[model samples]
Target: MAHHQHHNFEVDGVDDDEVPRNKCRTCLKQNTLTIATVVGVIMGAILGIILKSTKDKWSEREIMYIGYLGEVFLRMLKALILPLIISSLVSAIASLDLSLSRKIAFRAIAYYLTTTFAAVVLGIIMVVAIRPGVGHTEMATKQSEDTRNVTTVDTLLDLVRNMFPPNVMEACIFQTRTDLTSPSPNVTDVYKYNISFETVQNTNILGLVVVAAALGIAIAQLGEEARTMANFFHNLMSVSMKITSWVIFLSPVGIFFLVAAQVLQMDDIGSVMSRLGFYFGTVCLGLAVQGFIVLPLLYVALTRKNPFTFISNMGEAIATAFGTASSSATLPLTIRCLEDKNGVDRRVARFALPIGSTINMDGTALYEAVAAIFIAQVNNVPLDIGTLIAISITATAASIGAAGIPQAGVVTMVMVLETVGLPAKEVGLILAVDWLLDRFRTAINVMGDAFGAGIVYHRSLKELGLLEQSSEEEKFQVDKNNHIDETAQ
Candidate 1:
């Protein structure tokens, strides 16, 4: 063999020794954090089930310790949530090209509002049929004075109360901050002593969202300097996610506490569980029917695609949603699910999901409608035509407030109750059962994310004439090759 001669290209700045490299530890750690979140959720849920069921056999201190640990994980999540929302939102909307943003916005709104409206309507139907709230006695009202606790008003007053934002920037920042203090990242901070009615509050979700959306939208119209400023916020968003990932790693311990606490206080866990079962069953049936019948029907009717393919491709996202009750946290996973599995173009997935996470709370919408009626029935609050209309509208708006955040529906329920003159204190009655229902709602929320992806993909495919008979041929080939390889081995 001849001796090899070295090659160099100073002019072209070429070097032959460059080699493919492994990913950095940060990326690997990011992945670990993500996967760990799912694992923690599963393990925590399992441990919680056992502890809750065997509460009598366990020490009170043990349960409390676990509960506190779970709470700690939740707190960590909250720590990152606010800045993440504001910064990511500001950057996302700010960075979008104006025309594309408009296009995305139009499509996003069309999909989100329409789906949420459908969910609310479905909720109304389920709650009406089940009448969960009708039989239960009205719970004790809050002894303290709080306008938010209005239990005896109609929907009109709640509408008035929620009509406007106080201070846009402050609202979003404070909302983010307030949610941080709760076990739920997006929890409503119902103060023990009510603030003076004269004091203006900025914790309203609608107002906060509105403010964030406005500021975000406004950034695009800002001068060049603002764009530079917006870039900084983008950096902040990334930092926030980093923090969130770190918090998620310790989730197992935090989850233990949350589960332990709930199980600890119950005198007859079985009876409480029976009620929870009924509530969860109601929510699950509603979600299943909506996903299978309604959304799929929309997909089939509107575009040429197999809905089953869409759902199958979104498995990982659904898994993530099942574990983390927050839709915002699930956004990155949802987009990845669509791009990597569903074959959705990144442009659409990226453009659609963040907005969807913000406003497209189809799962919460369903809960609100269903819950409003359930609570109404439980309280024996009769609903005529006007009240029903009020229920539908207020519930729909409150659903917007649901924001894929934690226990968001509960606060929304309070919004509905305050709208319909029900005592806010009645809100706690639903809390005990809310956790189980929250899981199903999360599944549906992910389903909605997947559905939106399907809609976007279907439309794009049709526009490009890419729709064909099916993907079965390639799938068949892959299956056959796998089988042959297995036999050879």
Candidate 2:
């Protein structure tokens, strides 16, 4: 007989055994991300500096190829976006009981909105206190004349229109661009040639999610047919995740090229930093407060569990979020850790994580608030109390629709900026550091999703009389469970 010895480590009253062993594929992928992040940062910085210094010595072809490598990597990540989201959403919804679905969905969105609101408020306070954009007058002059000037009413209409695309297929397959001359133009030349002041935000991810979710819910209502569709979606999700694993393996190389290209494009990195350092610092500080302080406090308040244990278990998901700079791409891993490792209920995790990934923008909301105020400050636009409040509201709304991808906040930041009459083009000031900041924001976003999942799962168990329930409550839940079982059978 083989003998097994048990080993354990305890920290802060939580046993190490509470965390599942790290031999699983989730842990392996996370470790890969952690290593890739370190190696990629080192390689990116070194290669960026070298290429920037020797730019004149290299041929144009070589530089283009280097940039192309990074572009290809981004395309690879984008490739996973549709398939992963559709499959995951379908599988997550199909796995849940229909009645509990609404309850979980409401709780998840409520948690998401709460965290995002707090984040934006924190960001406003930090940027107001720090005043990051006070002295950078030169950056104000670098504006693109093409920035559209729309009224509040117009912006509201645009937002509504974008939320529901005319055709889900057009929304999914179409890629919106300001440059019509580029390949894969989705619209006619009228909007593409930059002749019209109107712009269409082509990546209607919210619309795609809405369509997929509707399909999933419909599939769930089909009873036995639901099982067939559920199996298909489950299989599709498995296949897509395998593809994601392959793509993630290339993260190190992708990060190096992306960062290097980012560096080479900058004429004077130091000058950009000196001007935007305060803005960047403020955003990071706000993110840290939200990720480390606010969200954990909420988690403890809800679950009465150790935040350290929760975060430790989430290490892989967080690492993957940072490396990919995407919550959507990291959704599979996040769901895995929450379900397989942390014991979050499948219903709660499946419902919360996917919805959270789509709309939960704690980090993005914080960044948008800071960026809007910073831009206003940089451009010498004084914001009154009323204007500040408006900015806050707009930031939250804009973040709801922000795509869970790298630098997605910047695109939506324009909406927030427009709310306060700031020059949308002044966003150029912070473009240099956006890539670096993106990783941090993505981490916070994923953490928020996990935290929401934890709270929802606990509440679900509580409702089932599994935790801290009276005898009457326990009996009530037992009857409810039997009823559900009979219905299922």
Best by lDDT: 2
Poorest 10 consecutive residues of model 1 by lDDT? 173-182
lDDT tens readout by residue for model 1, 186-283? 55544332333332332344454445556777777884858777778778866776665556556545544554465555556576666545555677
Candidate 2: worst-modelled 10 consecutive residues by lDDT: 1-10
Computed on alpha carbons, the lDDT of every model, listed in order, comes to: 0.63, 0.76
In candidate 2, position 481 carries an lDDT of 100
Candidate 1 has a TM-score of 0.68
lDDT of 2 by residue, 119-198 (tens): 98999999999998888777744564446544444445555665676777778754333222323466532323332223
